[model samples]
Target: MDQVRVAVIGLGMGFSHARTLAAGRIAGGKLSAICDLNPAKQEEAKATLPSDVKIWNDADALIASGEIDAVIIATPHYAHPQVAIKCLSHGLHVLIEKPAGVYTKQVREMNLAAASSGKVFSIMYNQRCNPLYKKLRELIADGELGEIRRMNWIVTNWYRSQSYYDSGGWRATWGGEGGGVLINQSPHQLDLWQWTTGMMPKRIRAFCSFGKYRNIEVEDDVTAYAEYENGATAVFITTTGEAPGTNRYEVTGDRGKIVIEDGKLTFWRLRVPEPEFNQQYTGGFGEPECWKCDVPISGDNPQHSGIIQNFMDAIRQGTPLIAPGEEGIHGLTLSNAMHLSTWTDHWVDLPLDEDLYYELLQERIAQSSSQKTVREVGPVDMSKTFGTY
Candidate 1:
């Protein structure tokens, strides 16, 4: 592959995307075009991008102009499907940002479009390429932890202030960004949860707190329970209100527990119990069978860069996507399930009713308190809030 020419949509995050592409982190990719509805943002992009790169106000114009072979859709959550479908219909490969679509039906439509177009359609779930997460999956698959029993994730470090929500009218509204942390910050964790576990939940029940941190109609704090078909259970918690929050995951299997936090993973191995103790401790909690411990993590890890490179490699070698566009529906489903469970006070099963989820969203949209024009929040300084991780 000489060069995988690329265009970017939504100059807010697209500016970052364009910058990364220009960095030439991807061996055979180049920033080729930029598109945004905001002329100011387009100008900002033009200022940053090489003079040869074209800028367009309309996505269709950019797609039709054929200046690039692929597009990176970094638009609002609601715009992902529409923009992806348009790009795919135009015979361009697409790499859409997380939360592939606001709902699964839109994702299905986009998937169908990609299938018909024979183009590589993938979601930007870069977390799946994280070295720690990859090692976690490998350990689980290797049966180092034995049969999986449960997984718990506390991912509240995604702290956001009311000012953050106030930064953009479209940010925390149903008609704009769809959901809150689940859609915005938790997609990466949600993708990691399922990706590392190598399983999907069969059912989910959750309760979400709205208007808890910001004046938003959607959830800012969510606690959801997932039940797997094999009788395994998982608990997921995410919040935007809690400062000095926690980012930790604990996976407990029959043999041991794997804990990951602050980019460090620790494994606690269970020791084998004596035959007499095993017999005497029936129906009770006691010491386990023979055990050992290890932290088998070592390498030159390129998390974000690894994912970007994977995208380029997938495009070049026709390899499978680490996170396929269709897989995004699972994370979306979990997020939607949390809201649905909270709104209706019910448990939601897999293959959620698209009409029902959309209906619930439409109700929230109707009642949404935001009427301000959705402006780009990029120009504002997020440097303080998005501190060094």
Candidate 2:
């Protein structure tokens, strides 16, 4: 198969994608073009390219270039759907950076665009590429964990400071980023949560704290509880303001519990209780140990590069995507549900009435007293053209 010519948008995270692709991490693909609004980024990228790469400041021009066969969009959360939809409409396979969209409607539109174009539409859920996670998912799928009862995702190591937020004016505001840790830093965790469990939250109740580090808006701390359809439950906790925080996920099932922390996957093997022991042990003040042991986890690949290569392989071989853009709706919906639950002081039910959520979101956006900030979209006046406020 010929090398798939791909163009990447947004120089921030997209730079790593470009570097990896150019370095041949994607065996059957090459980055033919790069787009960013920043002139210095364009100049720096151009200087770094291997002489034949094309750089453009306009995403539209890059999409219409006809030189690229696919597009990898690493722009902001809100921009992913718009750009990917455009590229898909132009018959380009798309790999969008996650959370997928700032809202559900956008994700639906992007999926429709992908379907109409009949091209690969995937999301950059790189964590799904982690071997530890792959093994964990395998065990869960094989019923190694039995019927999962509860799960907890405590991600605290994603520490962000005021300076991090200040690095880009658009980093923290509701309009710019849609949400904080959930959208920007925790898509990997959120995606993994749903991917491994094969469950979606039917209802969510959340509480959030804003502006602990910077003067910007959006929550830096969030604690949410979710209930699934099968009566299973999960707790998702995150904080961008914590230092040297904890990152741990524990899944408890009837057979055993699986714990993943600091890159180690440990499964506690449950002992089937003997009937004699169950009848005799009640006299004491203690209960029998239900499970024991921790499994050592070892094997990991370049996860981001792996996901990128997977996207390219799908393009070349017509293989099913590891994570489709449509599935992104779940994580995005979960995020919106959490935020909406917190904002409205009510439990947000799943299948989130998108219209109701959108109307509430519009009210929040209108009522938001946060100062506006804009990311430079090249030298063009984005004020009127982009309809960004």
Candidate 3:
């Protein structure tokens, strides 16, 4: 195909994707159709999208219509895997929004479907396009920092108001959107944590504060500790209830340390590797000489548009995907481990027990309740809600 036709499924987060595609911002790609069951969302799309663009309420019909070669699944946390599976089964390229799914078992099934279908599968991990992170990953991969010893990210800048939760009935409920901060606002960081460092924790222990600062049924605050097989440790802390919050990620290695904060990347380079310095120095008071350097980040953060272009390029030109759909399970694995740790009051091991996690998640869903009144909200400038890091 010279140009890949694309359809966006959910109008909530998918609306932004639909608008971008409809505007023809992505070369080699055209917005051919949109599907949303909500009449309000459909009308909004009709008003905003071109007249020729098809609109449908049934996703299955859109997939079977053969009007598009690919579908961007932007539905809620649960429907992500379901819709992607259906689209892949129909022999369509699939790109779904973050967190993959509410649980790992379902995400695994979706990944299997993608593998069997042999279709281009990607995830909307827009933050991966951010130059800061791109450079960070490059530096780590190039061994600018030696073997990682510790990682800490305090990304609490995702502050959300009560009305934000009240705007939709599915916002924070376990039965609906799944979990809060970790699943919603912090998936990018969770993904980036392992993506940049090239490591997944061997075990995770987490403490999640359910509705600690909001009137919701899910976790709005969380602090997780993780240990890697290489003896490296990581700490991930996030919340949607703090004002004047901070976004800081620090990674320490034998060579030195790197910090990304305040939109700047800084590296404290050691004259000699710490291990070398420690062994060579006879003076007990002496430490490795450190020089502070401001790392230059020179590239535009194309964000969502970049990912779309990459997806289309992958379909039309056989380019590799920026975020493969199968990798979505890594971040979700960390997330599930956190939730399981909290639910079981114990540290959970890697290669998670998918059945046990599913069982526990079902228990939460069965007992889930939402008492907040829904509020009508206007269009959210989603760009502003992207990662603060």
**Model 2 residue 5 lDDT score:** 96
Top candidate, metric lDDT: 3
Q: Taking the tens digit of each residue's C-alpha lDDT, what string does model 2 give over 1-389? A: 57899888887888889899888778899989887877777788888876678887777777777899988888766677777777887888899888798878778888888888889888988888787788888898998887888999999898877888877656777767777888888888888898988888889999887776657678889999999887889999998877889999999877778888887888886665333355767676764466555665567666778778889889999877888878898888888888888878999998887777777666655645534422321233321222211
In candidate 1, residue 345 scores what lDDT?
94
Model 3 segments more than 4 A misplaced: 370-389
Q: Write the per-residue lDDT of candidate 3 for residues 110-162, one digit (tens) a residue.
A: 99999999999999999999999999999999999999999999999999999
CA lDDT, every model vs. true structure: 0.78, 0.79, 0.87
* Model 3 TM-score relative to the real fold: 0.94
lDDT per residue, candidate 1, 1-389, as tens digits? 67899987777766777888887767888988877767677677778778878877766677788678998888777667777887888889888888887777778887888878888888888777667888899999998877788999999999888888887767788767777889888998988888898888888999899878778888899999999998889999999999899999999987788899888888887664243456677777657664445576777666555656677778889877887777787778778778888888999988777789888787777766655322222222221121101
Please state the error at residue 243 of candidate 2 in Å: 1.8
Q: Report how far residue 175 has shifted in candidate 3, in Å.
A: 0.2
Candidate 2, run of 10 with poorest lDDT: 380-389
Q: Report residue 341 deviation for candidate 1 (angstroms).
A: 0.8
The superposed Cα distance between candidate 1 and the true structure at residue 97, in angstroms, equals: 0.4
lDDT at residue 88 of model 3 (Cα atoms): 92
Look at candidate 1 and tell me the lDDT of residue 167. Answer: 79
